[model samples]
Each structure stands twice: as structure tokens, then as C-alpha cells.
Target: MKFTRRLFLGLAALLLGVGATMAHAANALDTIKQRKKILVAVDIGGPPYGMIDEQARQVGSDVEAARLLAQDLGVTLQIVPVSGPNRVPFLLSRKADVVMASFSITEDRKKVIDFSEPYGVVPVVIGGPASAKVASFADLSGKTIAVTRGTTSDQELTRGSKGIPSVSIVRYEDDATTNTAVATGQQDYIAAPPSTILAVKKASPSRDIASKFAMKAYPYGIGVRKNEPELKAWLDGWVKTNLKNGKLDEIYKRYFGMSLPPEVLQ
Candidate 1:
């Protein structure tokens, strides 16, 4: 009887040890704190959200937001550059602690990863040079549209052009390439956020690129891996605090030249 009791006690102790180890491994916030650094993924190629300034420094709304997060956490910030297609993959693979690369909150993305409260909004649009007939989907019957692969813009465009059989859709690996395709006249139109369309205009000033139609605006969120309740909760609180204090608005205005939506502010 004593031997059986001894064996039971040993088993209980082993179980407790295993449980503790699992809990420790799951708490990413603690691990970040212990490491004194947070790895944030940003798409540096996308301007206004993530970009390199003339001074050769990363300066963009998402980069600033990541910096603020690291500052509040009392940890150093290490940016992991990524593209639209790899944003979720990087987070799931543990290559990044958080993703702030203008990541839009979508029903489909939510199925794979968790997103914090939205920090900003992106107005997606279909844009082309002034001469291109792109006032509506019907106008795009014979035109080619370029979009970044795996981005919300691509999904929205695909859904919006369902019946436009003559419209050709071309996918690029990143926002820069997608915008460049339209900027250089390789594609007749580009389905992208307004900020990126503006970038396309700047890249080819002679083209007079402008948005032909609005394609719905989506709120941007910070992405974290699934099953990270603690980390996600902390981010949610942080978003609320920043939104109320005007800091997030300040960053938004700095890049977007506008205030956040009323619903988002509340």
C-alpha cells in the first residue's frame, strides 16, 4: 500500500512540473520581458505604413506604433521585415512576436490568427492614370489590374470583379511591385489602399494616377499568434489607451493626413 502511495505522489509531482513548464512556454509576454526585446514584423516596402525615409531610417506609422509598444513594454524593438503574403506565416512560425504592417482585420484572417483592436483604417481603391477608363468595374472590362498577392486588397478586388470576365488580374509579391506595375503603365489599374495609390502617383508623376473607385475601407490591426490570450489582451488595452490619449491619432495624421473614423475613436 505504501509503495502504491509513493508511486501516486511521484506521478502527481511530475504532472505538476510538466504543467508549469507548459504555462511558462505559452506566456509570450513574459518571454519578451525576459529577453528584453520584442520582434515586430513590418512591411518596409509599403510607404506610409512602413517605409525607409531619405535618411535611411525606417519611418512609418506601423514602425512608430511598434516602437511605442516596445517602449511601453520596457523592451527594445527589433523589426522583422515582411511582405503581405508572409505576415501570418511569420507570426505563426514564431519569426515575429507581433505584426503591424497595416494588417487589416478580416473574417478570413481571424480564423488563423488573433488581432488586437484596430489602430487605423485603410481605404482601398482601384486607381489608374487619368486617361484610363476605370470609373467602375464595368469600365475595367478590357483593362488589367495589379494587386499585391495575399493582401486584403487582392481579396476584395477578386470578390468585386467576379462577373468582369474580361478584366485581367495580375499578382505581385509586394506592394512596391504592385504599385510599380501601375505606375509604369505595365498595368492599366491597381487595386490598393489610397496611400499606396498615392505612392504610385509619386513614382510616375507624369501619369496623373488617381483612384477611380472606392473598394471599401478596412480597419488595421496588430496581429499576434493564436492562443496568445495574455499578449492579445495586453495589446487590446494598449490600443484603447493610445486611442483615448491622442497618440494613435497623432501617428495616423502624420502619415494619413486625416483623423481616424468616429466609430474607431469611440
Candidate 2:
């Protein structure tokens, strides 16, 4: 009888310990409320998504979206500028509460982190000087393509160019550097989103860059750390409200000069 009683007592203690662990687990929403700020990671390297304005201040679609999130949550917004490759790592390392870095939603990324419903869409494309004849993936043979590491463009180019042994894929750390390669003539072709290609043209007007072909368009979402149901749910609802109210589209049009994809709006 005493042994059974001790066993029961041990089980009860374990249950209490488990309960405590669960209670102490981090809930990002509550933490944000407690701290009165939401740290959002953004990549200013990419323009129209995130970039610097004439006043040297951060301004772009992603930047405005982050502000909206903080405004609606009643928290101060702290933008943590990051490179494209480090967006997920920053969130996982707790350096940022969320990632608003034009983060493309992908099956591979969803395996590690959680994403809110898509708020915007960006089309990936292969762009080069107007003189380059690269209308299709097959035409990439014997040409070099620059891409930002860890981006969908990089992945698509790498995968699609495997059959073309002569195609050389050069990877840069961020969109800014990738675009620079094209502007300076260090590389003739770039795999990036259309907005980034447009920024490249705007920066180097003499270069006469143009999109050669369109790849798949990807929907982007707010990235939250896994297991933060409260934060994820709140973000989902916030996205829905803003998307429905046309605020998200408004921000997109301001930067992209076009409406959000019809599918994303639905």
C-alpha cells in the first residue's frame, strides 16, 4: 500500500512539473504585450519590399506592413534590419519577434517556422540587359546568372538550370549585391523578383535591364516562431482584416505599382 501511494505521489509530481513547463513556455503575443514592443526583422537590401528613402529612413511595402502590425497590436514597432539569408535565423534566435522581410511562404520554410496567411505576392523572374536573348530557361545555356542566396529565385534557378551544364549560377548575400552585379556588368543576368529588377533599372537607368521570362509568383506572409499559437493566430486575424479592408493591397500598390494577385486577394 505504501509503495502504491509513493508511485501515485511521484506521478502527481510529474504532472505538476509538466503543467509548470507548459505555463512557462513563451507565448510571443503575451511577451510583446509585456515588453510593449514588437521586434520585426526586415531586409532593406531589397527595394519596393524594404529599402531606404531619400531621407535615409527605411521605407517600403514590408516596412509599412510591419508598422501596421505594430499599430494594430498597440505596440511600439522596432525594425531589425537583416539580410535575406538571415531572416529565418533571426526569428529562431529570438532576435526578432516576427519577420516581415518579404518572406516568401514555401513548403520547406513551413517545415521550420510558421507563416500567417499570405498578405502579398511577388513574381520571380530572370532579368538581364535588353540585349540578352534569354526568353526561356533553355536559353540560359552558356550564360551566368546572379541570384540572392536563400531566395526562391536562387532555388528555382539552381533547380531549373541543372540540365544546362554551361549555366553558371552566382550567389550573393543579399538582393542589393545581386542587383549590383548586374548594374556593374559583373554579371549579365539576375534571377530576382520583378520589383528588385525594377529597382535595378531605376538605379542604373543606362543599363536597360528587362525581364526575360517570368517564373512562378510566390505569396509572402508574416513569419512567426513555431509553437507561438497566440502570435500566429493574432497575425492571421490581423492579415485577414487588413487584406479585406484593402490596406494590404494599398501598401502593395504604393510600392509595386500594381494590385495584389487576384488569388491572394481572394
Candidate 3:
């Protein structure tokens, strides 16, 4: 009888220990609320999404969205500049509470970080002068195309040009360089992101530069650490609420000069 009683007591103690561990497990929501600030990682080089403004400040649509998110949470927003390759790493290392660096949702990326539902969309399109004879991807059989190295636009255009003969590709380090190549006729066309391309087109209103065709589109999402279910749920709902309420649209239009595209809504 004494042995049985001791065993029961040990079992109770084990259960209590398990309960304590569960209760004390780290939770991003609790921590964020307690700290009163959410550190958002962003890249200042990704134009329209994140970039330097005329005042030489790191500002972009993504930065503004982060601001709105902080406002919704009634917390302070702390911006941490990160490069494309390091955004995910920053989140995993707890260097940032969230990442809003135009992080595009992809199947491969899902294996690493949790993405909030898409907050914005940017299309990858081939743009050029309207006077250019190119009508389709096939039409660019032997023509030169400009793209930033390591972008979806570069990957897709390169993949599509596999069998096409004499399809020259010029890879630049940045979107501005690609745009300049097109503007100077050093490149016949530029396969680039929607926002940067739009800004370029707007800059040269009489040049007839326009989106010739789409290569791909990406719905950008806010990123958080994996296993933070509460944080993920809250972030997703926050994005959905703002998007549905037209608040996200207002921010987009304020930066990019148009409402969110219908494709983005889908």
C-alpha cells in the first residue's frame, strides 16, 4: 500500500511538471505585448516594397504596412534593415519579431518560416517601349532582355528562353540598373517586378514603356518565426482585416499610384 501511494504521488508530480512546462513555453504574442514593440525586418533596397526615399530615409510600402500593423497592435514599431538573403535568418535568430521585406511566399520558403496571408501582390512582367515589335515571349527569340540577377523574372525568362536561339540576357545588380539599361536602349526589354517597373514607366510618360507580358506574380507576406502559432494567427488576421477594410489598398495606392490589382485580391 505504501509503494502504491508513493507511485501515485510521483505521477502527480510528473503531471504538475508537465503542466508547468507547457504554461511557460515561449509565446511571441505574450512577449510582444509585454515588450510593447515588434521588430520588423525589411530590406531598404527593394524598391516600392522597401527603399530609400527622396529624404534619404529608408521608406517604402512595406515599411508603411509595418507601421500600420504596429498601430493595430497598439505597440511600437522597430524597423531592422535586412538584406534579401538574411530576412528569414533574422526572424529565426529572434533578431526581428516579424519580417516585412517584400518576402514573397513560395513553397520552398514555407519549409522555413511561417508567412502571414498575402498583404500585397507584385507581378513579374516583361516591360518595354510600346513601339517595340515584341508581342509575346516567343517574339523575343533573338532579342536581349534585362533583369536583375537571381530574381524570379531572371529565372523565369532564362528558363523560358532555353530553346529559343540567340536570346541574350543581361543581368544587372539592381532594378535601377535594369531600368536604365532599357531607357538607354542598352537593353531591348526588362523583365522586372511590377512596382519598380511601374515607377519607371511613370517616370518616362512619353516613352511608351509598358508591361509587355507577365512572367510571374508574387503575393508578398509578413514573415514570422515558425512554431509561433499565436503570432502567425494574429498576423494573418491583421492582414486580412486591413486588406478587407481597404486600409491596405489605401497604403498601396498612396505609394504605387493605384489600387491593389484584382489578381492580387485573388
TM-score per prediction, in order, is 0.97, 0.94, 0.78
Q: Model 3 misses residue 247 by how many Å?
A: 1.2
* Candidate 1 local lDDT, 33-88, one digit each (tens): 99999999999999899999899999999999999999998999999999999999
lDDT for each residue of candidate 2 in 104-197, tens digit (9 for 90 to 100): 9999999999999999987899999888778888999999999999998998888888888699999999888899999988998999998888
TM-score of 2: 0.94
Residues 174-245 of candidate 3 have per-residue lDDT tens digits of: 666777777766776788776766767766666567888787778888888888899899998898899889
* Candidate number of the best lDDT: 1
**Candidate order by lDDT, highest to lowest?**
1, 2, 3
Error of 1 at 213 (Å): 0.9
Clashing pairs in 1: none
Report per-prediction Cα RMSD to one decimal: 1.1, 1.9, 3.8
The lDDT values for all models are 0.91, 0.91, 0.82
| lDDT agreement of model 2 with the native | 0.91
Span of ten consecutive residues with least summed lDDT in model 3: 199-208
Candidate of highest TM-score? 1
Deviation in angstroms for 243 in model 3?
A: 2.0
